[model samples]
Target: MILALDVHYKDDGSAKSVGVLFNLKDSQPKEILVAYLEETDEYIPGEFYKRELLCLLKIVEKVSMHDLEAIVIDGYVYIDNEKRFGLGGYLWQTLNEQIPIIGVAKNFYHGNNETVKQIYRGKSKKPLYISSVGLELDTASDFITQMPGEFRIPHLLKQLDTITKEK
Candidate 1:
């Protein structure tokens, strides 16, 4: 199964809300799981993973890893071309690098390495940034490009963002 994950933070940044959507390959999501967590760490510059990782790990603990084929996150996998680990990369390492992690970002990150792929979807002139660990870059890009939706963002990913914010 494939899972898409996203986190929404309270306005004051005191709490984090997380959403996880599960889907089979090439299919719409079959389930969505949400979690709320108290923020323990401050959001430090260049250290976003610290805050978001806690929220993600909490939600992930509720699911069986054996059923997880890949995890799609709403960020980058690398901070720069130098291969620095981003939130997604940290998650992959924390999980022992067993499950593949794909990072899809709506805005272009200036710090992103050259390895990140730019993909345009629907009729939007803007492109989504795609990065990955445990899978080839092109393959990961293709997966997101084919995700269920005609607009720029995939339906399931947009759903994740909506559900996360609703919490």
Candidate 2:
């Protein structure tokens, strides 16, 4: 099973809504889990994982860890060319590096290196930025490229964002 995770923050930044979509292979999600969490830390400029990681972890705990083949996060796995950990990286480490993590970002992270793969979907000239931990970059990119979607973002990922924004 593959888990796609995303979080939506409240306007006041006091709380957040998190969504986890579970799917088998390149299909639609078979299950969707949502969770609400009070923000414990302020969003620091470069350290976004500190604020969002807790919310993701909360939602992850609801699912079976043994069944998870990989986790897809809406950000980078590495913060820079030096391979510094990002939000997805933190999650990977928290899971003891057992499950592979694929980070899919809409925009290019200024700090990422050549390890990041860019994939174009549909007719969009822009590409999605992808990075991974525990899986080869090419393999991760191929998976994302083949995900069930005709637009810029995968359908399940779009659904995850929508569910996260729900009240």
lDDT of each: 0.84, 0.85
Ten-residue region with minimum lDDT total, candidate 2: 17-26
Q: Model 1, stretches more than 4 Å misplaced?
A: 24-28, 111-113
Question: What does candidate 2's lDDT look like per residue over 1-167, in tens digits?
Answer: 88888888886765554555555454467777877765567889988999989888888898888988899999999988899999989999999999999999998878676769999998889999999999999999999988888898988888888888778
**RMSD to truth, every model:** 1.6, 1.5
Per-prediction TM-score to the true structure, in the order listed: 0.93, 0.93
lDDT of 1: 0.84
lDDT of 1 by residue, 8-86 (tens): 7776655555555556444456777777765557889989999889888877887889998899999999989899999
Which residue pairs of candidate 2 clash? none
